[model samples]
Target: MNKLQVEAIEHGTVIDHIPAGMGVRILKFFQLTTNGERITVGLNLRSGENGTKDLIKVENTTFTKEQADQLALFASSATINQIANFEVISKYHVELPEAIDEVLACPNSNCITNHQPAKTRFYVKQSDQAPKLKCQYCEKSFNVELFSELN
Candidate 1:
C-alpha cells in the first residue's frame, strides 16, 4: 500500500473543532478577500477516527484579541492551535465576547451606523435599558443594532 503525507508548517495558527457548517462562514467573516496564499481551510475532515470536523490554517498569522473574539462568537467550540517548527506550541481556547463590532447592524431607522460610510458598532444591551449605543454623531439610540448577516 502507498501512503501520502502532508508536512506541517513552521509557524501559524490552526483553528480546529469548528462546528460542521461554520468553517466557511468564519473565512468570509474575516473577509479573507485578498486571496492571500497564506490562508488555508479544510472542511468536513475526518478526525481521529471519529466524526468529520473543520480546520483552518493561517500561515504566519497571529490574531489580535478582537479577531479571536470575533471567531469565538461564530464558533465558540473552535480550538486555536499555535504551531511552530511543525509541532504544536500552544493551544488557545475561544471565548465569545458580549458584543462584536462591524458584525451587527443597528435597527434604528436613524442610526448612523446604518448610514453610508459608517463603521458599525456593537454593544451589550439589557432588556430594561434604554438606547444601546451612544451615537458618535447624533447622540441617539443606536441600540437597535442586530447581527445583519449570519455569515
Candidate 2:
C-alpha cells in the first residue's frame, strides 16, 4: 500500500501519535480556525505501536504549557515536536497536570462551579483508556466526554 505524506512544516509544532480520529477535537480544544494559521491534519494514519493515529502540524504556532496539558486529556501519548528551519529542535511528550482549573466545566448544573462565580477545578485521574476527572466543587467524577463541555 502506498502511503500519503503530509508536507513537512518549515517551522512550528508537529503533534503526532494522537488518538485516531481525535484531530478535530484537538483543533477545537485550541479553538483554531482554518483561516488564521497554516494547519495540516492527517487522520487514521498507520502507526507501529498504535494501530492507527492522527497527526497535526501547525505552522508558525507552538503550544503553551497549559494548552499542552489540556491536550493530555485526550492525546496522552502524543508527542510535540518543535521544528525550526525544517529541522526538529526539540521533542517531548504531553504531560497531564495534577489539577486543572477553569479549563473544563463541571457537567452538573447544580454544582457550585457552575452556579457560582468560581472557576471549576478538577483533580485529574490518569488512565490509559480515558482521563477521569473529579470535580473539586461537587465531587462528581466524569470522563473526557464531560470535560469537552468546557465553558
Candidate 3:
C-alpha cells in the first residue's frame, strides 16, 4: 500500500483543517488568488472518521495576523502553518477577532454603511452555533454567514 503526499512548499503558509465547504469561500474572501502566488488547494479531503476538510498551501507568501483572525469567521478550526526551508516554523489556530472593520458589509440593507461612505464595522459575539456580527451602523446582529464584501 502506498500513501500519497502533497508537495511541501519551501517557504509560505499552509492553512489546514478548513471546513469542507468553506475553503473556496475563504480563498475568495481573502483574495488569495489575486497576487499571482502559487496556491495549492485541497478540498473535501479526509479528516477524522466520516469527516472531511480542506487545505490550502500558498507558496512564497504569508498571511498577516489580521488575515488569520479574519479566517476564523470562515473556519474556526483552521490551523496556520508557516513553513521555511521546508520545515514548519510556527503553527497556530486562527482566533476570532474582537471587531472587524472595513472587511464585511452590514447585512441590513437600510444600514448607514450601505448608503453613506463609511467603513463597515462589526462587533463579534459568539453563539452556540455560529458567531454573530453586530453592525456598528444599524445596530443589527446577524450571523457571520450573512456578511459579504463591503463593495
Candidate 4:
C-alpha cells in the first residue's frame, strides 16, 4: 500500500493528536489566519491510539506556554512538536494548568469577571475522561465546551 505524507516544516510547531474536526478551532484560537503564517491542517486522519485525529502545522511559529494551555481546553490530547532546521528539536504533550487566568471567558454573564475589565479566572478540576472548570468569581462550574463561546 502507498502512504501519504505532509510536507515537513523547517522551523515551527506541529500540533498532533487533536481531536478529529478540531483543526479549525485550533486555528481560530491561535488567530493564525490574520497573521499570514503558512498553516496546514489535516482532519480526521487515521490514528492508532485515537482511532481518528487532527493535525496542524504552523510554519515559522512556535506556541507559547499560555497558548498551549489554552489549546488544552479544547484539544487535551494534543502534543506540541518543535521543529528547527528540519529537525525535531523538542516534543511534549500539552498540559492544562491547575488554574488559568484570562485564557478563557466565564460563561456566566453575571460573573464579575465578565461585567468588568477583570480577567476571567478558573480553577481546573482534573478528570481522567473530561475536565471541568469552576469560575473563581461566580463560582460557576462549566465544561471545556464553553471555550467555543469565549468572547
Candidate 5:
C-alpha cells in the first residue's frame, strides 16, 4: 500500500487541524498569498479526531506567537509546526489571546478605529458557542467571525 504525500518545506510553518472551510479565510485574512510564498492548502481532509480538518503549509515563512494565537479565533484546535530542514523543530497548539490590537479591523463602521487614528482593539470573551470580541472603540461585542478582515 502507498499513501500520497505533500512536499515538505525546508524551512517554514505548517498550520494543521484547522476546522474545515476556514483555511481560505485564514489565507486571505493573513494575506499569505500576497506575500509570494509557496502555500499548499488541503481542505476537508480526513482527520482522526475531528473527522475533517484543513491544513496549510507556507514555505519560507514563520508565524509569530501572536499571529498563531490569533488563529484560535478560526481554529481553536489548530497547531503550528515550525519546520527546518524538512523536520519539525517545534510544535504547539494555538491559544486564544486575551486581547488583540491593530490586527483585525472592527466590524462596526462607526467605530473610532475606522474614523480616526486609534488602533483597533478587542477584548476576547470565550464562550461555549463562539469566541466573542468586544470592540474597545464602540464597546460592541461581536463573534470572532466578523473581524476576519485584516486591518
Candidate 6:
C-alpha cells in the first residue's frame, strides 16, 4: 500500500462504496463544492470486495435522512458511518426508498415535480438491474440515468 490516504477525521459522516463516477454527483447533492469543513474525497480507491470504490468524508456535517436517501438512489451499495474521535460510533447501509423526494426535479415539463414552487419527489420504482423511477405526485416515470445534478 502507498499509505498515501489521509488520516481520518475526528467527527463527521463518511460515505463509502460510492460508484466510480457518482462521488462528485453526491458531493454536489450535499453542495460540497467549497467549504471550511475538512471534507475529504477519494475516488477510484481500492476496495477489497469490489476491487474499486469511492469515498466521501464530510467533517462536522450532519447528514439528514433525506440527503442520505438521495445518494442511496445511486450508491445503493454504499455505507454511511458516523465517526467521533476517529472511531465509528455507528453505521448504516443506505437503503434507497421505493420513492425518492426533492433529490431531483423531473425533466418532464408537465410533471408536477417540475414546478418551481413544488416539492420534487419520485417513486424509485427500481434500484437494481436497471434503475427507474416514477413521479409520486404527477404519475410521470423516467430513467434515473436521466436525472442528474446541474453543473
Q: Please name the candidate that would achieve the greatest TM-score relative to the true structure.
A: 5
What are the C-alpha RMSDs, in order, of all predicted structures? 6.3, 2.6, 2.0, 2.5, 1.7, 2.9
- How does each model score on TM-score? 0.66, 0.84, 0.86, 0.83, 0.91, 0.80
In model 1, which runs have C-alpha deviations exceeding 4 angstroms? Answer: 1-7, 33-35, 48-50, 102-110, 116-119, 124-151
Candidate 2 vs candidate 5: which has greater lDDT? Answer: 5
Q: For model 5, what is the alpha-carbon lDDT of residue 69?
A: 96
- Clash pairs (backbone) in predicted model 1: 106-145, 107-144
- Candidate 3, residues 67-97: lDDT per residue as tens digits? 7888998899999999999999999999999
What would you estimate as the lDDT of candidate 4?
0.82
Instruction: Score candidate 2 by TM-score against the native.
Output: 0.84
In every candidate, how many clashes are there? Answer: 2, 0, 0, 0, 0, 1
Better of 1 and 2 by TM-score: 2
Expressed as tens digits, the lDDT of each residue in 96-139 for candidate 5 is 99999888898888888887888788999999977899998799
Q: Which scores better on TM-score, 3 or 5?
A: 5
lDDT at residue 13 of model 2 (Cα atoms): 88
Clash-forming residue pairs, model 4:
none
lDDT of 2 by residue, 1-151 (tens): 5465578989998999898988998888666554488889998988986599999999998878777777888888889998999999988899998998777778888998776789888899977688898989889888877655453
The residue-level lDDT of candidate 4 at 122 comes to: 87
Query: What residue pairs clash in candidate 3, if any at all?
Result: none
Instruction: List per-prediction Cα lDDT, in the order shown.
Output: 0.64, 0.83, 0.88, 0.82, 0.88, 0.76
List model 6 lDDT by residue over 1-151, tens digit each: 6665556898999998888778887776556756678789998987786577889999987677666766776688899888888889888888777666665777787775555577776777773464688877778778766776432
